[model samples]
Structures are given as C-alpha cells and as structure tokens.
Target chain A: MTRDELLTALFPAGCSIQPGGFGTLRGMAELPGTGRVEIIGIEAGTPLGIEGALILSGHVLDLVAAASRAPLLVLVDTAAQEMARREELLGLNEALAHLAKSLALAAETGMFTLGLLYGRAAAGAFIATALSTQMLVALPDAYPSVMDLPSIARVTKLKLETLEALAQTTPIFAPGLEPLFATGAIAEIWPPEALAARLAATLAAPPPRADTRDALGQARGGRKRAHDIAAQVMAQAAAHG
Target chain B: MNAPGMNAQSDYYYEASARERAQGLLDPGSFTEFMGPQSRCLSPHLAQFNLTGAFDDGIIIGAGLLQGMPVYVAAQEGRFMGGAFGELHGAKLVGLLRAAAAHKITAVLLALDTGGVRLQEANAGEMAISEVLRAIVAARRAGVAVIALVGGRAGAFGGGGIIAASCSRIIVSGHGRISVSGPEVIETNKGVEEFDSKDRGLVWRVTGGRSRALLGGADAYVADRISAFRDAALAQIPNAPPFTLESLQAEQARLSQRLAAYGTCRDATEIWRQAGLEPPAPVADLSEADYAGLSRLPEADHDAR
Candidate 1:
C-alpha cells in the first residue's frame, strides 16, 4: 500500500504529518476516542539510520518533557537500519539505543505507546523503535524478521531451498506477519480496513508489558520451549530461595 | 576446581564460561544458578536444524550477592552460538528480570557477551529480545539498578547492544566491544575500504570499551580482570539512580549531542577530539586506568535536570 493509504487507514479522521527530515513521518493527530498522540512513521521502502533515529528520539524526548501525557504512535515500515560506512563509523548503535531508551522512558512514565507495523519491520530498526512499544499490532501484509531470508541462509550456511522447506513447518525461521503473530511478537494482525477501530480499542486499554509472549507462542505451537524454559528458571529460583 | 569459598586467583572473565563468570563476580558461595544445565532448557529451534543446543541455551540466570547486597545476575555464554538469544534464552532473561523487580533485588547484573539474536530462530529471537527490553525497563522502574558488564570476547552487538544501553549503568572491560551492527556486516555491505572488519585494531577503536566510554555510550571502563568488573559493579549498583523522567531527558540531550558531534566523522579519534579531548590517547593501547582518567562526559544529575 502507498504511504497515504496506510496513514488514512491508521487515522481515518485525518492527521497532519510532514517529512521528519530523514525520510520518516512525524506529526500530531487525534484518535477517535483517545486523546491526541504524537506520531512517528517510517516509510515502507526507506532505510533508517542515525538521522531517522535522532528524529524519533527527539519526538519522544519532547513528549516526555511536555505536560501532556499524549501517547506516541509508532508506524514502522523499514527493512533495517541503513548499512553504510558513514553510519557505522558514526556509531549507529548509540543512535539506535537513544531511540530505544526514549521509548522505554515513555513507557515507564505511564504514557501509552503503540506500534503499528504497516510494512517491513526488520532488524535493528525494529528493535530500536517498534519493539519499545507496550503493544504491537501489524497489518496482514506486514513483514517482520531479525534478518531477511537470504541473509539468514548465508549465516546458517544452508541452501535457500532447504530453508524454505524448513520454514513451511517452523515459524521460528520464517519471515512474515503469520510467524510473528504465531510467536505472539505481534498482539494481533488486523485487516487494513479495520486498523483504525482496532487501534482505538487497543489505545483505550493497552496490554500490560508482561513477559507472556512465550506462553502465547507455545499455545500457538510456534515455540514450545520458551515457556518451559522460563518455568524452569522461575521454579529453580523459588526452590533456591 | 578451587574450594567453593575460595575465589580463583586467575583472571577468568575472558576465558571462563558464563557460569564461572557469574560465580566469580558474585561473593564467594553467594551465587545460585536457576535453570542451569541440569534443567535442560535448550533451544528446540536448533534441534530442528540439526544443530546442538546447549543445556541452558546460552545464558545463565540466578540470584547472588554483590558486596553483601542481594542481586540478580544473567551471564551469556559466548562459546555457545556467540551468546545469541533465541526463544528460550530470551525468555529466561525476561523471567529473571521480572523476578528481580518483584523480589525487590538490590541490583541486576547482566554479564553480556553476545552477537545478538539467533539466526536459526530469527523471529522468535527478535521477539524474545523485545520482551527482555520491556522487562529491563520494568526492573529499572522498580528502583532496581540494572548494570551491564561487557567483558567477554564476544562483547555485545545487535539486539544485545541495544539491551546493554538500556541498563541503568554500563561497565565495560578494556577488551569488551559493543555495537548494534557487527563490523563484518558493515564490511560486507560497505566494502572493506570503508570498514575493514578483519582489522582488529580498527574494529576495537570503533566499538571497544575505550571508544564506547569516551563517546558516552558506556558509563565506566575497567581492567579485563574479573575482580575489576566485580569491584565496578559493587561500587555502582548500590548508588545507581532509579529511572526518572529528568534522567531520561538528560540522556536524550547527551545522545543528541553525540549524533550532532560525530554524525559526519569517519574516524573514532575525531569524535574524541570533538568531545574536547584533543591530543587524545590511543584508546586501544591505553591501560584501563588511563582510559578512565581521560576527560569524559559530565555525570547526569537526574535531580538537577
């Protein structure tokens, strides 16, 4: 979908957003039932880097300093952080950390935060921005992964055909909204037409940021070991104490 | 092995296993590992790919005492998959951090030596790390000091790097390196001329403890010895400030300044000079003590901010 289409679906009543000076979208808009919120949106095909992370961080910092407790709406659509010589030399990790910490601060302060993955939410960019939210909702077509399939194949030293065959049975190695949803990384995958209404409901009553995804993943059959491992850890701690 | 109460005399922080590091950092006989190798909480994803899974995945989590103060610790095993986080490993960390906050632990020490998310379980690893971030924030909100110690050979990179930065305080040994993207990835994408991943010296200058300390990414620099790390953690954990709006605001400003000052620079030395440390000491060559003596960013006054 085009950027305008996605924005309209997210904010049906309309919102004003301008270029965030780094190919990102940032602005303020009112939700249907919830009060106004600051919006930071990354375009679908663009790459995020130091500039983009700084823009997002600046917005979060401003919101925290403000008297209003306006929630932050993060719309993610980047494949990954920009992989360039300049970005690496300049410490892109620190830049991304700033963004993550800003979002974490916002969440800690009781400001509702929501992440809507409209397109690609991949790699460091996903961790820096989208993963910081209290709740994450994705469109049916959203693509989320640690790394793309080709990169994964290279790192694993496996044939693409073999990996693809494995992906058919396991959500762990797959890259799509389905596998993410199965793992409970995404709270829900809503249809594009219903995104605005679903978002309003989620904002009104956001889920607590508890570590329940592992259990959810187990129930969905995407991950069977996470819940058991956590259980063992907790049990051992209790037994020792 | 030495007696349970006797601290090993050698510097084992770099070569020791995750459990050994945890045991060495904590007070003698005070460490108690949960979900250890006996629990067999290995990664199921690895088995599917015909890869062997370590019994504890790649992390060791438990409660311990640091200088007599109650603390929870999580140390990643660098030898096992480069300390990557998969579904089980990430959940283990999340559960431990949650318990730390709930139990009102005095501090939470994370001995990180990772290259970030596991590639075999890409989606699961990413999600697990995300949950781990949330848990760390919660623990900090509860007034628990979350300290990250990056000293192992693997250092911390990718998602692990971001998690390290989210902690209340970061202490790195001279050999530790931290970055979001590994140098090899950068070299592959941007060419060797832009960033020679094979040049260990250049890599260290870009992401090592010294550079990270000078750039305001890390809070302290210590020697490569385990005792040095333990001492640093003891000094900071009890006095570390809780997460507050003012402190976060200050952090925001500091990061903004960093981006503004070094965004265009192609060399790590230039960043040191921009920070007003002209005639900068060679970061990789300087002793940890000398590196810590250099001029650095002013400590954030959470209350004053």
Candidate 2:
C-alpha cells in the first residue's frame, strides 16, 4: 500500500504528516478516542540510509523530550538499508543503531511505542524501524524479510528454486505476513477494514512493555525452546550470576 | 608496539573459541554457564535442514567475575557458522542480558563475532536480533552496563554491528570490523568497483576497528589480544554510563555531528584526515605502535560515551 493510503486509513480522524529526511515521513495524528500521537515513518521502498535514519532518530528524541509521555506510532515501509560504500563508510550500522536507540529511549519514557507495518521492510532498515518498536502490528498484505530468498540461496549454497519451494511452507525463512506472524515477529495483523479503530484500540491499551515475541513464537510452534532457553538462563542467573 | 601490551601472549581473541574467550576474559573458574555444551543447546532449524548443529549454538552465555565485580558474560564462537546468529544463538545472548537485569548484575560483557543473522533460519534469526536489542536496552535501563568486546574472525557485520553500536561501550581491536553490510554484500548489491570483497586491506580501511574508533563508532580501540580486551572491559565496567536521556542525547549529537562533518567523504581515510589524525604512515604499513596508538590522537569531546 502507498504511504498516503495507509496513513489515511490508519488516521481517518486526521493527521498532519510532512515529508522528512531523505526518505521519511513525520508528523502528528489524532485518533477518535485516543489523544494525539507522534507519527515517525519511512517512504515506501526507500532504502533507508544515514541521513533518513538520523532524522527519524531526531524525531524520536523530540518525542522523548515532550512534557507529557505521548504515544508514538512508526509507519515502517522500506527496503533494506542502502548497500553502498558511502553508507557503510559513514557508519550505517551506527546510524541505524542510533535510530533504534532513540526509539528505545522513547519507550523508556513510559510512552506507548508501537509500529504499524502497513507496507514492507527488510534487513537492517527493518530492525532500525519496525523491529525496534515496543510492539509491532502489520497489515495482512505487508511484506517482511530479513534477506531475500535469492540472496539467502547464494549465501547458504542452496538452490534458489529449492529455497523458493521451501519458502511457500516454511515460516522459519519465508518472507511474508503470514510466515512472519507465525514466527511472532509481528504481534498482530490489523484487519483492512477498521485501521483507524484498530489504531485507537491499540493506543488505548498497548501490550506490556516486557518483550514476549519468543513466548508467542513458542506457543505458535514456529519457534522452539527460545523462550524456554531464555527463561532457564534467567532462572540460572537468578540463582548464580 | 604492535602487541600494544607487549605481553607477547598467544591468547589472540580472534583465535579463541567463544567458551575460551569467556573463560579467559573472566576471573579464573568464575564462569558458571547456563545451558552450556553439556546442555547441548543445538539449533533445531539447522537440524531440520539436515545440517549438523553446534552443541552450544555458536554462542556462550553465562556469568562470571570481571575484576572481582560480578558480571554476566556472553561470547560468540566465530568458527561456528562465522558466528552468525541462529535462533538459539541470539536467544542465549538475550537470556544473558535479561538475567543480568533480573539479578541486577553490575554488567554484561558481549563478545560479538558474526555476520549477523543466519539465512537458513532467517525469520527466527532476524527476530532474535530484534529481541536481543530489546533485551540489551532493557538491561541498560535497569542500570546494567553492557560492554561489547569485538575482535574476532567475523568482525561483527550486519545485525551484529547494530548490536555492537547499541552497547554502552564498545572496545574493538584492529582485527575487528563493524558495519551494517559486509563488503561482499555491498559488492553484490553495488558493483565490485564500489567495494571489492577480495581487497582485504580495503575492507579494513572501510569497516575495520581503527577506522571505527577514529570515526567514534567505537569507544576504544584495543589490541587484538584477549588480555587487552579483558583490560579494556575492566576499565569500562566502572565508567560505563547508564542509559539515560542525557547519554542518548549526547550520542545523538555525536552521530549527527559525525554525519555533518564527514558525510561528504567517500572513503574512511577522508574521515580520519578530516578528524585531523593523519598518520605519518598508512595504517597497514605502520608498526603495531603506529596502529594501536590511536588514543594519542586528539580526543573528541563526544568520546566520553
């Protein structure tokens, strides 16, 4: 979906989103029942680089400095990070990390930090934006991938055809909303019809700050023992560390 | 000069296994691992793919003492899948950090050595990194100092680089390279003229530890020895800043200024030259002394983090 279509549907109550750094969107929106929320987002398919990330991070920092702890919604729709020498040379990792850190700081301020993945995302750019949020909900048609199957095939020495065939049924390495949901990377899939209401409802009562994707993944059976392992380690450290 | 400490120790961090690094970094016999090799924390996904899995899943997680100050330590074995983060591998680190916060442990030492997520288990691996990031920040918010120690064969690219960058303090050795995408990935995405992965020296200059340190991407540049890392870790433990709005603001400014100052530069050398730290010799040709002596350069005000 286009950014405009997604934003309109999600904030039909009205929003004032302005074009932001390099390839970003930032502004404010008011839901029907919920108070104003700061919207930080990326333009569709724009591979996020240093400039865009810094600007997004700056927005997050601004939200943290607000007098009242306001909710922040991230509209993530982008490809992976720019694969260029200049981006890497300028420390894209640090830039993306800073963006993630800023979102983390916002979460620390007792704000309801949530991401609405109405478009698509992958790799470093995804982690810096959609994946960094306190909770993530996605549109049913949203696309999410860590690495493309062709690239994954090249790296893993598996045939692209084989990878493609497996991706259809395998949630572990597949790229799509359903597979991602199965892995619990996406907390919920917002129905297409009631995005604005969904936004308001989610804002009214957000999930607990404690991350539970692993537990969700475990329960869904897409992942195994990740939650148990973390719990065990927590238990051990409580007794020993 | 090359050895920095001149200890002439064969305890090269790049050569050590995750368990060995964890053992060598902590006080003798202090580490009590959680779900260690004996526990066989293998990767179910790798097994599903008919690939053999490492018993420890490429990461070592547990707690030990750093300078008699109780801390949680986790290290990655670069030999296993180039230290790529599989589901269990990422979970182990997350577990360690979460445990640190729960126990109110003073700090968590992270030895990063990976090219980020494993493609075989991409969904789980990617989600693992996100969870790890959440865990790290959560631990820091709870007053646990998370210090990343990087000096391994893999050099912490991709999500590994992002994780390292998020740490309260990062100590990188000449052997360590940190970046979002590795050279080959770039070469694949953008042509070889942009970045030839075979050019090892070019890789070092672009994403190597010295370059990362000079650019303020890393806090400290240490020698490649495990002892050097341990010493750096010991030094940073007490001084590690708690994750607060003020600290992040400072970091934000530091990064912004960095972009503004060197954004136009096409090469890492340009950044170094712009920072006014032109070495008398090229970094590669310089003796160990010339290379490891970056701290002697003018300290940037933003280096406090």
Candidate 3:
C-alpha cells in the first residue's frame, strides 16, 4: 500500500495533515484540541543555494525559530546536506549548523523528537536527525550512507564498472538500509504494514533525556565509544603537544 | 606575474583557476595557504588504483580575510577526482576547521565543488565529514560563523549537499545544483521520465538557485560573479549568533508551512508564488542580490509565527 493509503487507514476519521510550503520551515499540527507538530523530511537541497546550501539551511533555522510548540515528530527523508558550488559559496557548514541548532533546540525543549527515516538518510542528514532524537526507526527500504554509489565513483575515480561490483560485498562503499543497520544508526526497522502504528506509539511516548547519536555510533561499531575514541585522540594530541 | 601564456586572470569567471580565484576572493594578500601545491599532499589511494591526484590533496585549505575578519577557507579542486573528499582531503578540512574553532576565529568559508565521500578512501572521508559537522556545531555554539560558497559546474551533490545544509549560512551562485543525488542517480532510481539528467531546466528546478531560494534553502543567491558572493558573505557573517529556542521553533514552523505550499508543485515558479513572491517571470528575472533583498522573510512575518 502507498504511504498515503496507510496514513489514511490509520487516520480514518478525517485527520488533518499539512504539507511544508516553500520558504517555510515549520509544519503545524492541530491534533483535536492539542497543537502538535509533525516535521516531515528535513532533507537537504530543498533549498537553491546558488552559492551553497548551508547558508539557506541557516535561514531554514530562522524559520524553525518562527514555529511554536514542542513534542514534534521529524520524518526524515534527506540523503545528505546540499554540496553544490552554490552551497559552498553560501557556506554549507553554516547552513547545516542552523538545522542542527534547530534540532538541538527542539531536543532541549522536551520536544519528543522521533526520527522516522521513511527514505534515505546519510551523513549530515543522519547526524542532523539522530543527534536530536531519542531513537530512530528506519523503513526497510530506506538506504542510508555517508555517500551514494556514483558519488563514490566520482570521488574515488574508480571505474564505474569496478565500483558497482564492489558495492555488493563492501558496506563501506555501498549505500542502503543494510549498511546503515551495520553502522548501528538505526534502532529498529518498521515494516510498511506496521509503520503507522509504530509512529503513533512513538508520538505518544515521552521525550528522551539524551540523544542516541553517540550511542548508535558505538552500537554500530563505527566509533567504538563516541567520546571514548575522541577522548583518546584528544589525550594523545595533548600528550604529544 | 602572469604565466607565459596565461592571462593575469581567466576569461570565464565561474571557471577561473581555483587557486587564482581563491586568492582573489579574499582580502588582498591575506591568504596564507596551508598544504598548497608545495605540500604535495595528493591522495595516496589515487596512484595505488592508478588514478591521478592533484597536489594539496585536491583541496586548498588556509587562512584569509573577509573584510579584515579572520577567516579560514577550504576550496575543493574539482579537476582532481571531480574534487572528491578523500582521507587526506577530509583531514585537511577537518584540521583547518578544528584549528579555526579552537582559535576562536570569526568565520569559516568553504568553497564546495565536489561529489562527497570519496570512495577510494570512503571510510575516512565519511568520518571526516561527520567530524567536520560536529566541529561546526561546536563552533556555532561558541559563536563563530561558517559560510559556504557554491560556484562551479561541478556544483554540489551527494554528501556535499549535507555539508552545505549544515552551515550557519549559505551563498550560492546561479550555476550550482545542491542535491543528495545528482540527476543521474535520480534518473537511475526514479526513471528517465521522472527526471531526465540531461534536461538542464529540470535539473535546475530540482536543485537550482531559483528552486532552492523558494525552498528557503539558500539565505542569499548571488550572481555567477565572485564579487557577488563576497558581498553576500560579508552581509551574513555579522549576523551570526546562537539562536534561542523560540527562534528555532519559529523557523521549524516556517519550513513546515513551506513544504505544505509547494511540496507537490511541478514548477519552480509555483513555489516562488507560494512564498509570496511575484510569479515566475518576475522572480526568475531578479538578480541574485535583488531577489535576496526582496525575498527575506519580513519582520512582521517572523512575529506572526
């Protein structure tokens, strides 16, 4: 069934769902008497940063600051942040920082930040959502990676034919839900049939005290122990210096 | 000191020499290049796989001045591996940012033009970008501004897009395309009918300046000229500060409204109209700066939220 169909079935009594408008960052939710928000798909490159995407992302944060209320549900669908020449000119780092700050602020406000990766989530987008959430649920089909296949080819300059072959056996070069699973970025995968119920249950739950980005990192064997590894590096640097 | 055959400056402003452009973009004589061609920090993985690598590890990292404010800049050299972010490439960038933040520098400018997460050194590249993001977060928390400049045919794609999105502010030239997957990947996955990679107009609408501007993804859209970028960057750097929760929540509300208005729109013009701009022709024709000036969300609008 289509995602719309599933939502329709779950919200049979004429529920109100809103779409994110252009130049507008926040999505509102009027749940009966309560004013709940559903932040769907804070993806990258939704902006046209002729110079860079990050500058616009910072502006997006301004829009986020405009929104009121907490306990939002962020449905994540970004593959990564924008990395165009325009984005660089506009300051990619600063743009993404805005979104990160927004998410961090949301997480700080007792906002029940639930991440639902309905599609792809990689790199900065993954960090943006995961860093702010208590836990993240990935749809089975969603593919997450730091970068995608062809990009790997372009960056690595490997023959397309060779990279395609390597993608099958190597999780490092390949992008998908399975690789993300191997990375421990995902806490659970919700079957399409169970998506609506799971989301509803998540929305009903309380906000988590701590973010799971570092935890997920350790869980996936990517960094070993978040700051533990970073601590090691810092200690070594300090000793050497 | 012009080279024997080379003009003091190149003809195509957008495609000018990366080094020359980087030098010219900042305050005169302010740039102190790190690594540089002299460093010979080319990708080790490149020659092992028989691929060529550029000197300075395919990225130019150093310090410069933007209007006398101390700024650290990193520019990707697209000529090398399409400016892929390799281990050394990412490390140089991360190191520069870490130092800049540690020193309490005022700003960081990243001139991005690459397909992110270099596959030859994919693991290190990915880790590096993640670290950079964390670094930027730290910098922002401590009151530093980061600005990304997107100008070049290579534009930004893949992981590069996320890096752009993470910045505190962004400036884009008309030529850039910021997206997770360039048209090729979208076409491969969604079919040619959904997105023809060759369709310049379609590609622009998906990730181009006008589309992103309407989407509120870019803070300012500059002309293809480099000076335009300098002006926009200068304007944004001063406004950088850690935002309060109310401000962030407001921005979130605005994004939600924006997606609602044009999430299904077929044309960039349509999105522009919904964003309170005069329809297609007018918005499309405005110069990058003029459009940005007119398009900023009004104070009243912010208050209403």
Candidate 4:
C-alpha cells in the first residue's frame, strides 16, 4: 500500500504527516475518540543513514520536549542501516541507541508507543527502531531480516539449496514477516483493511509494562527455550536477591 | 584486537575466559553464578547446523558483589563462536537483566565480547537483542546502573555495539572496539578500499576503545587489566543516574553535536586531528600511560580487586 493510503486508512479523520529533509515522516494524526497522536517514521524503501536516523530521533525528542503525552505511532519502512564506513566511523550504533533510548524515555514518561512496520527492516536498524517500540504491529508488507540466508550459507559452508531446505523446517533464521511473527517479535499481523478501527482498539488497550515476546514466541512454537531459560535464570537470581 | 602497545605490566583481560573475567572482576568469593557451566544452557539451534556449542552458550551471568555491594554481571566468551548471541546466549542475558530489574540490583556489569548474532539462530539472536535492550532500559529505570566493560578480543560489533551503547556507562581498553559494522564485515561486504580489515591499525583507529573514548561514545578508557576495569566500574556504577528524559535530551544534543562536528570525516585520524588528539605517532602506538595522559585518564592503581 502507498503511504497516503496507509495513513488515510489509519486516520479516517486525517493525518498531517509531511516529509522531512531526508524522507523522514513527521507530523500528527487526529484519531477519532482517543485524541491526536504524534507520528515519526522513516520513508519507505530508503536506506536509513546517519542523517535520516538523527532526524527521526529529533522528532522523538520533539515529542518529549512538548511534554506530549500522546501515543507515538512510528511508521517504519527502511532498507536498514546504511552500509558505509562513514556511517560507522560517525557512530551509527550509538545514534541508533540514542533513538531507542529516546523512545524508551517516551514510554517511561507514560506515553503509549507503537510501531507499524510496513516495509523491509534489517539488522541494527530494525533492532533500534521498530523493535524498540512498546508494541510492534507488522503490516502485511513487513519483511524483517537479520543476516540473510546467503551469508549464512557462505559462512557455514552449506549450499544455498541446502539452506533453503532447512529454512522450510525452521523459522528461527529465515527472513519473512511470518517467521518474525512466530518469534513474537511482531505482536500482530495487521492487514490493511479496517486500519482505523484496529488502531483505535490497540490504542485503547493498556500499555505494556514489560517485554513479553519471549513468552509469546514459546506459545507460537517458533521459540521454545527462550522463555523457560529466562525464567530459570530469573528464578535463580530471585532466590539470591 | 589488542593494540600493539598493550603492556605486560597487567594481566591481559583480552585473553581471559568469560568465567575468569567474571570472577576476577568482582569481590572474591562473592560471585555466585545463576547458570554455572553445569547448567549447560547450550544453544539448541547450533546443533541443527551441525556445530558444537558450549555448555554455557559463551556467556556467564549471575549475581556478584563489588566491595560488598550486590550487582548482576554477564561475561561473554569471545573464543566460543566469537561470543555471538545465539538463542540461548541471548536468553541468558535477557533473563539476567529481567532479574536485575526485578531485584533492584545495584548494577549490571556486562563484559561484552561479541561480534553480534550467530547465523545459526540469527532471528532469535536479533529478537534477543531487542529484548536485552528493553531490559537494560528497564533496569536503569529501576535505578540499577547498567555498565559495560569492553576489552575482549571479539570487541563488540553489530548488535553487540548497540547493546554496549544502551548501558548507562561503558569502560573500554585500547584493545576494545565498538561499531555496528566492524572492519571485517565492512570489508567483506563492501571492499578493501571501503575498509581494509587487514589494516589492523586503521581498524583500531576507527572502532577501537581509544577512539570511542575520545568521541564520547564510552564513559571510561582504562588499561587492559582486569583490575582497571573493576576500578572504573566501581567508580561509575553507584553514581550513574537513573535513565531520565533530561539525560536523554542531553545525550541527544551530545550526539547531534558529534554529527555536526565530525559528520563529514571519512577517517578516524581526521576526526582525532579535528579534536586535536592526533598523537605524534599512530594512535595505536601511544603507550597506555601516554594515551591516558592524552585522554586525561589518571594512572590506574593495581590490586583494586
């Protein structure tokens, strides 16, 4: 779906998002019955370099500076972090962390936050943005990948065909929305239909106070050991504390 | 990844095992591992790839004391899978951080030594990184200081770099490095011209601990000694503030200033020169004491542990 169509569907009342200097989406939307929510996003199908990431972060800080208690709707669509020496030399890792920490501060300050990932997201870009949100809803178009299968094949000395066969049996390392869904990284697989009502419903729900994807992953059968192992450690640490 | 100037005056933290680092950094007899080696929290996914996994999944997590104050700690073994975060390795850290938040531990010391995700369970490892970031924020919000000590051979790349940045403070030795795309990954994907991974000096100058410290990416720069890290952690943890909006704003400005100042530079040497920190020799060749002097770091006293 096009950006306008997605925004219009979510905000039947209409949104005022505008493209920033580098393709970052910013502005606010009037959500019926619940009030206005601020928006921050990376434009679809673009690599998120240092400049774009900083602009995205600037929007997050703007919300905080306004003392805005409105929910933050992060529209994510990126080809992931820009792969360049200058980006890393300038500390892309720290910049991404700054963005995530800004969002965390927004959440801790009592504002509800959610990310609508509607395009491909890879590696550090995905981790520090879409995954940093309080809730992540994957649109039908969402495609999240870590290290790709090709790279894995090369590193492991396994044939590409063999890797494909193994991918069918395990979603743990594959690159698809459903695989991410099974891991509970994407809280819900959101269809383009009825976007307005669905968002309103999600906004009305109580905010999450703890990260629960591990439990969700276990229930979905994509990941079984994470929750149990975390619990075991928590239990043991609790005993000593 | 240790710099050539690394001194023999100190026991090399770069060569220590995960457990050895953990035990040596904390109070004697005060470290009680939650999932010791016997727990054998092996990565279930590695076996699917026909790879052997370690009993502890290359991370050591547990409660320990620093001069009698209780804290939580995680030490990653750089030798095993280059300390990559497989499903189980990541889970162990997530669990430890969750416990740190729940118990209001004084601090969470992460001896990070990772090159990021293990390809065998890449998705799980990625998700685990997200969880770990959230838990670190939570722990800091609960007034628990999250500290990272970096000096291991693997030198914290990719997701590992992000995790290290999320902590309240970072202590780095000249041997340590932090970056999303390390030299090897950059060179492999891009080209030798983009980043010559074989140019070890350039690699350190770009991503090494000295560079991070100079750029304000790290809180402390120390000797490659376990005692130096212990002392720095001791100094920073109790004093680190709870994660706050003001602090975030301050950080935002610091980062923006960083961009405005060094954004166009294509090399770390240019960056250091702009900052007026270009040593007479290769930054890597500066002695620990001389570099520390350049960095305004006081001489570290021995036997702090």
The candidate scoring highest on lDDT is: 4
Regions more than 4 Å wrong, model 2: B1-9, B294-305
TM-score of each: 0.94, 0.96, 0.63, 0.95
Give the candidate order by descending DockQ: 2, 4, 1, 3
**Number of clashing pairs per prediction, in order:** 0, 2, 109, 0
Query: What is the C-alpha lDDT profile of model 3 across B17-43, one tens digit per residue?
Result: 566556656776777777667657666
Q: Put down candidate 1 lDDT per residue, B1-305, tens digits, no spaces.
A: 12222456566578777887888888888988888788788787887777999988889989887777788889999989999989888889988887777777778899999999899998888887887877887888888889999989889988888888788888897778888888899887778997899888888888888777766677777877777788888877766756776766776666566667677777777776766776345767766566666776453222211
Model 2 chain A worst lDDT run, 10 consecutive residues: A61-70
lDDT of 4 by residue, A1-241 (tens): 7788888888877789889966688989877778888999986768777788778877887788888989999988887677788888888888888888888888988888899998888989899789999999978878888878898898789998988999999989988898888988989878788688889999988788788999999999888899999999999998886
Report the C-alpha lDDT of model 4 over B72-178, residue by residue, as the tens digit. Answer: 88999999998998888999999999999888888899999999988888889999999999999999888888999999999989899999888988899999999
Clashing pairs in 4: none
* Cα RMSD (angstroms) for every candidate in the order listed: 2.6, 2.6, 8.8, 4.2
lDDT over C-alpha atoms for residue B156 of model 2: 89
Chain B of model 1: TM-score? 0.93
Better of 3 and 4 by TM-score: 4
Clash-forming residue pairs, model 1 = none
Tens digits of per-residue lDDT for model 3, A1-241 = 3344534533443344443442223343444433455554444324322222223244334434555445555556554544342233222333454455655555554556666666556665565554345567777776666656676576556777887786565444456776555444566888877655666666666665533443454556542333243333233323323
